[model samples]
Target chain A: MARLTTPLTDFYAVIPAGGIGSRLWPLSRADAPKFLHDLTGSGSSLLKDTWDRLAPLAGEQRVMVVTGRAHRAAVEEQLPELADLNVVLESEPRDSSAAIGLAAAILEKREPGVIIGSFAADHVIKGTRFFNMAVAEAVEAARAGFIATIGIVPTEPAIGFGYIHATEETELEGAPSALKVDSFVEKPNAHTAEEYVESGDYLWNAGMFITKAAVLLEELAKTQPELHAGVVALAEVWDDHAKRGPAVDKIWPTLKKIAIDYAVAEPAAAAGKLVVIPGEFDWDDVGDFASIAKLHSSGYKKDLAILGEGARVLSDASSGILITDTGRTIALVGVKDIVVVDTPDALLVTTTANAQKVKSVVDALRISGRDDVL
Target chain B: MARLTTPLTDFYAVIPAGGIGSRLWPLSRADAPKFLHDLTGSGSSLLKDTWDRLAPLAGEQRVMVVTGRAHRAAVEEQLPELADLNVVLESEPRDSSAAIGLAAAILEKREPGVIIGSFAADHVIKGTRFFNMAVAEAVEAARAGFIATIGIVPTEPAIGFGYIHATEETELEGAPSALKVDSFVEKPNAHTAEEYVESGDYLWNAGMFITKAAVLLEELAKTQPELHAGVVALAEVWDDHAKRGPAVDKIWPTLKKIAIDYAVAEPAAAAGKLVVIPGEFDWDDVGDFASIAKLHSSGYKKDLAILGEGARVLSDASSGILITDTGRTIALVGVKDIVVVDTPDALLVTTTANAQKVKSVVDALRISGRDDVL
Candidate 1:
């Protein structure tokens, strides 16, 4: 459980993937989300690939996971070698702050000085060497008592992700160590997103973070006392996790529903205690179906059937079958900038312009009590 | 098997249903034809229904059928009580006349004075009472030595059926005997069909006929000697049908390919021997899917999902869900006059207007070589 690099103690990679991804409808339901799916056909899940890139520096047992009770079996199935004790299962969905707090409390018991590097289980990262190098640099900055958050080098003016403002760099250790985060910006409209990307100092907040467990707890105690108290309470019972598990679950539902950035990082940065770890890795949160288009080297043409030139990527083309009964043949005809999912039972045809609005279909189905579709 | 009814002996009924219907695609393929399908939902076939209506008049043993070699088993399955000796199976498909001649030759031996009445195996007759009365009248005309073909009383100017012109009728022996058929017409264009329907003298040439076997043979001898010679050759060894059956097949392929109407009836009317017996019965050919809509009372939303209407003859309201998928749900929203056939391999979403054109989809699938869908 002690975070130690082969050369030096660099970072402890922790994945939090507990959200029920109901937006994917039939393919990704409450029982299984997009992270567990081999949607890319690479024979590896996003979580599996994320772990493979991190294990070299974090060491095998140094990497841990915080997932939901529903996904525990799936997580174990994907990472069989991942020890059952290292994988933390949330009794119910509470939010990112509680998840991060749970991870920090668990790791603090085994080791005191270890830095926690957190990433989402469903993020698609390209260029592992660059990401590993960045995490190592962030680890060094964390030991120097700065809460380090990875700011991804922006590839597009994507309005889907939050952005960070960088003021000036601090001379620390390893690669580029730290920068004072001027402010945190929420996901903006297209025009504002374009402005942010054009600004040289702004980077997309990757949600990946590196910080000493004790330092994070200290910051949380000052800024978000309620969250800090809940984490402390769970830490007391965590020593005998098997016995006190039910008692911990009984208290979980009352915890504040908040993201880590809102409860700690943003407020900490406001009080002059935040640092930006400039991530050199090519990264994507893989936010939606359209984002999957960026995974291939050919930019949506060679790997996909991009009909009407840059408008659509038609996957599942086999034989000369332009139209099939929803399995192998799909035709993206006369449609431009739309996400058309052709499943056996349901056909979701909507503009990529309205990609975020896909959740509305699930919402409407839920309202109509159509659980069979939802 | 005597044809005597009360004091007189006269007519016969023959059915020919041998062509394997491939147009219906998956439901009706190379091995199964239209007559064998229980399309009416009564779990009784079109052939069986035709036999049921014809049985009382023709007498069970006298109601003969001529079919291709492949369909003999299906015929036996539908009519289980049929003796092996009563059924006639053709060696090959050479046209209706050859099939008829094969039956005629066999019946001529068992009974010398038999008058054969022929009908299609897969036709629908709505007015059975009128149909039975018409056949009785035709039998008297056949006894008077007139070769009688039933002219269906026209209900519509349907371009799908051929027409017959009955110029004059004869009254003899307390029955309306026959009409001199002036001319025969092929399936005409809409305008001509409308004119034929309004002309008051024309009736649909239903491809059914009643005539003395001896008179039919004499007519065949004068009109088509080649056909008559084939029949004679087939009859010469009719006593040893089992032994001579192979020799009969060898000579059959050499005979001219022709329909009975073209070979005998059209030419026989030049001598005024071909006469029309007006069938007062409701008759339907059931040529296409559109015809199935007729079995129901109304063509529109009478039995379908009707709004603010309660006089439904049948309604799939209240959990009458026709679901094909275990994984997904089907929603029928604001739609009527539609047939939703959901197959595992393919789905048909079309209106009953387009139901006849479903054959075009089968044709398209054949062209695409999507045999799984077919």
Candidate 2:
């Protein structure tokens, strides 16, 4: 939430890092997920990079990470810049929509105009300047009673990601604001993905939202009354816990498990209250290992070896990805685009397309009592 | 040449372990060629195994290895049973014919009519009973003044190995009389290989020969007069330090670099002096990594991790040719009759047909300056 007109030193960021990230598995484990790995060895993790970009808009002290209790240690270890108190440990995964509402409840004492811009932890964002500008625009829009969602300009007909059917821009007083959203669409097949790309009205739903705590809470209260009531109850005990401490574990399970977009944002959009901010920022929720391959320049399409191809950002020798200890040789031959993740005990080699299926492998291993592989 | 009918003691065996084995690059290096590796992991080298099999026939004290100077240490290390005096180290690589002739010159002085069964170090001999019996028969034939070579029974239309053409059995007073070798054929194409298999008269040239020093020398004199003269001139100083010593070192370069079969056996076969002894042994000359893979039996044909499906001669999960170990836990994928060699630097995925082409890959690598891969 923003507390300044120009650039907020008091604005807040809520990141949901609880997803299993199965698609990026072998690399993303139970202990560490996609956010923690510098899939592109650009000296910053997806989460850390996301935080670095957001820190200018929202201050570091005000930003919060909602991750699993198991991953809290890893997340903190990766991002030592984060204050210990700022990490909101989720006892169990309750989905992203619920996570956003929970963050609002915890920071309820902040002013009504305090704008919260929720970002995905595992996204590849280009055009950082443009992104910061877009975030600033959303904060301004949020201050003016509008719940803003940034829609990505689709580059290709990608059916893998969610889509947003956005309306025309309506010039606002403070900022050149986009119009209210018409609808949200799930990932479609190739035909629909192509159709979505052709149709200029459809924008990639980037799972990013900008809204004041008060308006978000009000919308939740109106659209998702059950979730709102649960949050309100939790908020009653929020201050006591903020000052002294009591775990929020008991309240989370009782609350209906649902995404905020499903219970509130979609309903709010349908009810003619949600606004789609048409903004241009090269944003990618790097969903799998294949996407991570795209993050850097390498001989990805052909078989290659990085013997001393020094200072390679992301050395992906054919299928093998290496985050080497500086100038280590990564060699490969006859291996296709597989994700050869070489950790100490576990070695995962799966097709990049089948990275999402890695969760199935882990599940099968667990069922077969081969916990050693996991 | 046949002075005694009985099996003599103190018989010497010479193994030429000098060839670069270029086709088997990564696995067979100059420092550690095919003979050095435990391709037949019977707790011995291929050279050692050959020696072990032959030691009973030729006493251990009389077993001599004719290898390049560089490979002398490895040769001795592999066959520790052989004393330092027995391993005759060559200064340079002369062809096989010259090598055999050189060994003959050395053995002539030790014992006249010495039965030397020249065996290749890198062959897989199955059915030891059949092999030893066939060897004994060949030995008797050799004593009776026949230039004998053991020809293997053709199991398949294998275009990779050379063929021996034997028209009819010779009526001779020996253990199992020799077959009159019509001629020797070079490695054939698919059509010829198929025809050779169907004809039943053609046998795989086993590269195994059995003959006395005098018999071979006489045959060389009758068939290859020029080579016979050269070998005789080299052998004249058998007891002296002139030709018997490093005289061939100067003369060998002048002699044509030719295979023994081409220089002598083919000429002899054409001259009606050659005998083909049908090898009853199940011999597999492991030509490349693929030949090594045939020894392993696993349920999966593709990407096999040989956790040993059956109780065979030898089995090790960690060792065995891997086609590719890109960290993808291969299910072996229910394949039959395949050779999968996996190396950290390179992977060789091929059926038996293409196994020989692995040499082509090595050649290309060498040409391309990929010495590191080798």
Candidate 3:
């Protein structure tokens, strides 16, 4: 942690911002998705928080945010210090691989050997000191030409996220704790998640990757040649500043819709060109109201967690979350683990046990022709 | 039911409207009560429903409604056909004894041998044909010099309502089914309610009473002389039209705040002067969300019962009542027997099992100084 303050001048943080998070229901809609919300109750949107976390390490010049065009204005409004060149507006979604690959290609063209770390815009991370230290180590490992990922030390058997299997006793010169990557696995059931926790060799894949920009593009060129050529062709003309828009409009939609985990990370791990650096920081995707409630409880002692401003609540024997932004008072009685989301146009009531099924509510509404609320 | 179509010309119906219904919070508030809302999902309000149910039996001119002075304007708005003189406005709350006693005394003065029936404005009565037949028989028994009460045939062992104990059938002309009421019992325990239901002698005391106005006043005079005298003095000037307001303002607050059951019906039943005509009508006090949900299900087969207009509901695996007038769409997933009430300033979420405890939400609001919402 002591050697972490010098600032990684060559580091570029790339934020791939997507996902509607339907499991969060009325709060996270299609037009105004999860990355745009202030899920931490910190009075700042998650996109801005992501910028805040990254800008300190890479400065605004090297910090980049790639989001859909619908959210570009909101992202600009939230991050007042962000320069226009650092923000990439997608014409449409083409999944994580295309989004992150384009950022890696552009930064590699901007400054070859520039170290880039991609972090999701909607995730919450605590213990900034430990995160800074882990990123410093990952940057050191990335300089050794290995695509380095910061794996979170598992605190519980969370069945909501993907896990990374790291083999022991392998290290990079500058990073003492860097280990060889074995595989990237899917979200497990409760029993398998518990077994993974007990193994002590697995960590949660935070979808955070640190590597030299040239190394990421080289790997993409080796595995997905067409995708690499398309992004690299756009990145070459991006700084010409005149042909950038036309070049992106022509080539962006043709890129494949696939996640980076499937396109690059898994194959690289299988080929022994991937490395894992474990991070000791608290993180959550804020997947549902239950996760937000748990995050909210860490700040207060009340059994009930109330979000939004100036909304009064009177609850009894209830453990749940009540969310309202319209200044409407919510009164809950004799309900446990219930989720009440009160907005101006919609209201949703269910329990935490049905957290994952909240997407079904959106699906049902879509099927019922409630597109206005959606 | 065939003998019920002819109008009961001499029967004056008195509707005593009160009770804020704290158990149905956010929907039932201090400024606007349950009786003013359309809890039935019908186009009209409960007060108007009460008027609609009574107008066919006793013409609009003979129907009387007694309510608080604060609700006088709303009552007038809902019951536009009601004559100005027929609306008895209480200066303040003096409970049912004084409210109904004044209506009875006034109707007795307006028409000398008038038979008056007191029905609650907030109760729901189905099977109008059978209800009319029962009231006709009760009126006949009332004409025979006995105070008559309608006893609802219990369909379940509900422990929420009082039971009426009736003895062997007595001889009454034109009222063959009328039996002498032995006593009026309070709400019983679950076991006691089951026993009372099995005994075949007990019926639910629906708080509906019919009698000659003169007989009711005389019984009131015998049991509670001071209360009877105060109401009688007020009634004497009530039809003076000019002096009615000043007279009621002077004498109203002096009367005791006691229910009519304790003041006259219970004592009269013990003295063998009370008779019960068993009614085979579907009756509900509309006590809580469960009752309203049940009433709603009988009309529509949807798992969720939505009350009022302009509420779009998408529910899955849920059965309960959703009351919203704010035009907000409510999406419920995986919850059963849930009660969600969405208003402009407040919202409430609970289940049918906790219906009776909703008053505690109001109590908690009062304790927490949220009087604006309450």
User: Can you give the DockQ of every candidate in the order shown?
Assistant: 0.08, 0.13, 0.84
Query: Which window of 10 residues has the lowest lDDT sum in candidate 3 chain A?
Result: A1-10
lDDT per residue for candidate 3 within B149-200, as digits (tens), equals 9999999999878999996798798778899999999999999999999998
When summed lDDT is taken over every stretch of 10 residues in candidate 2 chain B, the lowest stretch is B307-316
Judged by DockQ cut-offs, is candidate 1 incorrect, acceptable, medium or high? incorrect
RMSD value for candidate 2 = 6.8
Candidates 1 and 2 compared: the better one by DockQ is 2
Chain A: TM-score in each model: 0.87, 0.86, 0.96
User: What are the candidates' C-alpha RMSDs?
Assistant: 9.2, 6.8, 2.2
Ranked by lDDT from best down, the candidates are: 3, 1, 2
Q: iRMS values in order, in angstroms?
A: 7.5, 7.3, 0.9
lDDT of 3 at B296: 85
The sequence of per-residue lDDT tens digits that candidate 2 reaches over residues A125-198 is 88876677677777667777788888888988886788989766756555575677889999989999998888
Top candidate on lDDT is 3
Tens digit per residue, CA lDDT, model 3, A215-307:
888888888999999999999998887998899899999998889998899988999988988998998988888888889887553578888
Q: Which candidate would rank higher by lDDT, 2 or 3?
A: 3
What's the best-to-worst order under DockQ? 3, 2, 1
Native-to-model Cα distance after best TM-score fit, residue A175 in candidate 3, in Å: 1.7
lDDT of 3 at A359: 89
Best candidate (score: TM-score): 3
lDDT of 2 by residue, B207-323 (tens): 777778776777666656776677667666645655455765666566556677876688778887778778766787778655666565332334333411221111112223443
